[model samples]
Target chain A: MHIPDNFLSSPVWASLDALAVPAVAVVSRKAQKSTDSNRLPLLGVMGAFVFAAQMINFPVGMGTSGHLVGGTLLACLLGPWAGALVVTAILVIQALVFQDGGVLALGANVINMALMGVLCGYLPALALFRTRWKWYGVFLGGTCSVLASGILALAELALSGIRMPVALLEASLGLFAVNAILEGAITVSVLRAIERLNPSAVREEVVRSGRATWSKVIAALAGVSVVLTAAGVLVASTLPDGLEQVANKLGMPFGKHPAFRSPISGYQINSLGGAWFSRAAAGLLGLFLIYVVCALGGHLLGRMRRSYL
Target chain B: MRYIFREGNTQDGVIQQLDARVKLVLLIAFILSIALLARPSAVQLAVCLCVLAAIAAAARLAVIQVLRRALLVVPFVGFFSLVVFLSGDGQRAWSILAKSYLSALTVAIVISTTAFPRLVAAARFFRVPAFLVEVMQLIYRYLFVLAAEARVMQTAFAARGGSTGRRALEASAGIIAVLFSRSYEKAAMVYQAMCGRGFSGTLSRAEWRPLRVSDIAILSAGLLLATVVHFISI
Candidate 1:
């Protein structure tokens, strides 16, 4: 799911943006090192394939349609590094050209759909490849990748201090779970088709039997799961359980603290008494603020860097 | 697939006339300021909206286009916002919805005003890796070609009584596989073409233009405005 701007607080999106740059750099570097020639064109064509694939929506049951997110599929076909890079490029184009996600939130979007999605998908596929259930890796990878992305997005929103009821979070999770299954089925069908048509296209030297790599991949996947679980716990603990008192106990300053009181402080408009209107207004104000601040910061940073050079 | 080509309306207004680098800076500044604010006041939101409107007008962008593009993010964000509302934090839910729309609008303005090639050139100026930039350009160039192929394939499928269902999905998967193989061949041909023309490992860089004094002035003014908005309490 492409997170729109203003859904995430500045700290959330900013840190994600920071993390994504280096992650993408590393991916690009790895991808460059692996291929000898025509790498650029290869990535370009793959990216186009992804973009075009996303446009062709298929009818899932219940009169709903879903398109391929392509993270797992790309990783399966191109390996993880090149796969992530291609997805990142597609995301960039979607944001800048299609306005699919927020420009400022590009970092988070890339991290969610490109980096984490690829890793989650690729690692599982790698581990499963050694087993009798080799083909099942595609299905598992596709499902896991989407689920991981959804959880990460929720975790980010929680970390940003946006509290929603447990029910709401569960609802979102449920939706993603279903979407993940569909994605998994699609990935499997597509991969199988590719294999049947041209086995070499889906074949890679790395997927061949190697014990050491399998252990490492499994370990990495375990580590990611552990970290995600811990993050979920952290999010759960912070929910409105005497939040104000906890902040006070922690010596966190609260209430009318800043010189500039946000027009909508605490997600409530002061003058408006109705809960919905105040909340909506507060939401609107929070969004506007984020849009202004991130845009400004990115601009100043770009300018300063240029001047310094 | 409705591909969004750059409008090339760089001759229309002050925003369009500004150097691509300067326009990028201004857009970033506006986006950064929005992101930095912990909670923007209603006044601040209004001010930002006004500023966006002013920029759109200056750039000669159609308001309807900007609005339509910005609305694309609503369903995604709106779903979560609805959940938040159901959970009783109506304020945060509304805030998410509003903020996402404004952010989308701000980005739309940037893309509409600046030509896509110039924007890509600006990214190159920022020292984004040459490989990444080259890949992006190639993807943009071939996106339409592949998309057209996909469209033709889908049309042919539908003509053969391919209604939406499980069978359609299976058929679509086959189409995708075929597309991947076709695109792979196309990539090889493209590499061959590049090689034929004395293909160096790197694509040729675009000509760089030094930032003019006027461009610097505009950037500074934009930054100054952002700073003023940031510090303003209301």
Candidate 2:
């Protein structure tokens, strides 16, 4: 799922590259500020461990085997922020040394696999790790992480104007679903086995049974927005006509002049003249407001809590 | 498994001697130009390819080898382009496939010539965080070792007929668990060793020399070539 160079159009890549630099900085800061300064070396060795773990394959039947994707597993072992930093380092090494991904596409890959994958994976792990449903949460985290990344990858490609037939899109989605399940299964079993072996390895972080950490709540909210954003795109792709009919019932005045003129007047880019364009425009802008709302609410909540303390 | 990057390529090439910072800037500008080009005639594509080949020759790398390495992007891009082709836009499909291939070759060539450690140093020069760069350096250093260890475990497991039953999954997890513990212990040892050597939070960088006039000349030439390619296509 590593995007190669030139696969993304300029706007998509440029904007993502802009977004990723700060994101990486934030996580790197967190990793540095983390209590265990020893985690620096641990991060590197853990990265190598995940990289090498790929060599040990799990048989998925029919003479095929798949290895760990490592995002969720990394989150389980290391905290998500540090885990994200490790994944980012792994990605850079992969791009530069192995040609696994393109240099320009590094930002997109980092956002998708490193940031989103680890955060989404960690949300579930945080929820389930101390409970009887610990393993199930791990499985869900793995699946959600992979699935989230895959959807974002597909959406980016689509926005790049790569037109896939509906059938191909569905087929790829199905493939991603299968891959997600396998990742989930692998994460569950591996974490379980590690828990059994060192007894204390998995419990290092697991013993933290406090109120959901401030960051976890914020990450969960961010994860929800990511899922919503992807969902908006998917919905716009598949159900635009129905949405439009509902819009008309509520009287958007698409061809009329009584109401205020929205920027994308008919949910379409003015320079473009396709139903798909309108759907895409609406999907992208619609959720952006929701994301902003989430951000502001989180900020206010954080401030209020800080003041009370 | 074999290591993918052949380290010796950085040893003798003239391209390898260029300032890593200059090369980094030039490579990015070149790739950006390639990505932004909307449509190029077949003549333009051939011209770009020839120029790329000439650059490879200048680097003392085989043009064919760079082409072959760049073809790694084809399977991934080809599938997308094939769908576009099947949808009846052969020209757009070709543009997507060919342009991305050219861009990939450009990246592969630059990376081949520059040592990754040098590149990391360049990245740091360009404002990548000190800690992140250090972590990346460590990961690259240990990658081959851990990969080899993993291969040995996989082979041992396979030899023991561990692939047949449902137990293989658990056993595979066990392998990763063991790997995790070993890596954890190794990291502890590494930290101690580093601290023994008067380690600090940051790693030391390579000795510095200012970029020479030749570096600027090469960069200008590269940018001019990128412009030529863009306008030539236009």
Candidate 3:
């Protein structure tokens, strides 16, 4: 999603812009290394192709349609570095020429869609394609890329301190999930068609055979998820505090009266005096409980599946 | 499909006369100032708009054209603002809409006054990589060509009684694949043509012109005004 200007707070956009400058530089350097004299024209033509392709929308059921984001597709065709560079150029043109995104938020847009989207899509596809499931990798890459972009966008919105409801966040995630599936299907179809017509056009880097240690990768991913969960709980615990700060800034009365106090109001035991320790204790306990339940469920399911097998 | 290009150079105006480099700098400063604004007041938004309008008038552009182009950002930003509104942040939602509109208007004014080629050249002046700038220039040039080809393909598809459905999506995918192949071949040919003309790796350009005193004066005045407007809280 193109983050329009003003949606992001000043600090958020400024830091993103700062991060994006070096990212663009690194991507440009990598792209230059991979390409030769033909690189400039090819990049240009590829960009034009993407621009033109986006104009032709495809139906996505229910009389609604979605255009190709092209980040994943480009990365699949060109290498990821070149792909990111092309997408960056497209974002620039979109911002300057079409005003599709905000000028000031251009860096955030680039970081979200161009850099992160390509790498997320490309890395997974690369790892997957190394195995026997090449097509599956392509599909997964496309879907994951879109999902990652959507998640990043959500994270940005939350970090902006908008204090959106949980339902809205879920709705956005659900929407992106649908979009990701569509993107995956489209990416698969397009990649297969390219393979049939001109096999060489598909980058070799994507399909290079390498031994991927699945267990290690899964462990790493699991570790990341656990860390992320903990971080989310921590953020959730501090959310009301942030809300109160905003409320105070706006001169609105908040948290003075009990708004239907629960057993654990604001992530703390109400019996406890709403201290930091109580909130932290409640949050950590909740996290541990969730881990225990998940581990137990997984162990039981694995055992059941083994019995059936 | 119609393509929008730069306007006439014959129109002698203050903004039009400024060096592209100076204009680019001023554009960045203005956008930065607008972006830095948090919870901008009505007066602040008005001041920003007035500045944009003044620039538009100085460049002798049609107010209607600039506004119409600026309005294109509304639906995209408006959709998000609506989401924010639904989520119970009314003030932030309005701020997003207003700030984005002003930002878009400012960009429209800058782009409308400056030629795209000169803008690209100005990017080069800022030490933006030559390859990136070259690719951007080529992309801008070939965008129209590829767009027309895509239009023709769409027409042919429709002429054959192509209807929207899963099949249309597959057909569109195939069309895009074919377009990629065509563009690839075209790029090869374009590269060959460039090679035939004793071409170097870089896209060569004429010597850069030094900024004039008037350009510096204009830039200083614009930055001064922008700085004042930026720090004036509410």
Q: What is the C-alpha RMSD of each candidate to the true structure, in Å?
A: 7.2, 6.8, 13.0
Q: After superposition, how far is residue B113 of candidate 3 from its true place, in Å?
A: 1.6
Fraction of true contacts retained by every candidate, in order, equals 0.67, 0.67, 0.61
Measured with C-alpha atoms, the lDDT of residue B188 in candidate 3 is 96
Higher-DockQ candidate of 1 and 2: 2
> Candidate 2: which docking quality band?
acceptable
Model 3 achieves a DockQ score of 0.27
Model 2 Cα displacement at B81 (Å)? 1.7
Clashing pairs in 2: none
| Cα deviation of B111, candidate 2, in Å | 1.5
Write one digit per residue (lDDT tens) for candidate 2, span A1-309.
888777776556656775787788778877877737677788888998999997787888888888789999887787777889999998988876667777778889999999998988888877877799888888999999999989988877765656566788899899989999999999988888787777777777545432587866887898889867765555544443433443477776543322224454434465655443334444345335434544465457558868998
Best model number under TM-score: 2
Please give the C-alpha DockQ score of model 1: 0.38
Q: Candidates sorted by TM-score, descending order?
A: 2, 1, 3
Q: Sorted by lDDT, highest first, which candidate order results?
A: 2, 1, 3
- The global Cα lDDT (0 to 1) of model 2 is 0.77
Task: Write candidate 3's Cα lDDT for A36-119 as tens digits.
Answer: 888888899999999998887778888898877788899888888889999998888887777777776788888878877887
Residue A97 miss distance in model 3 (angstroms): 0.5
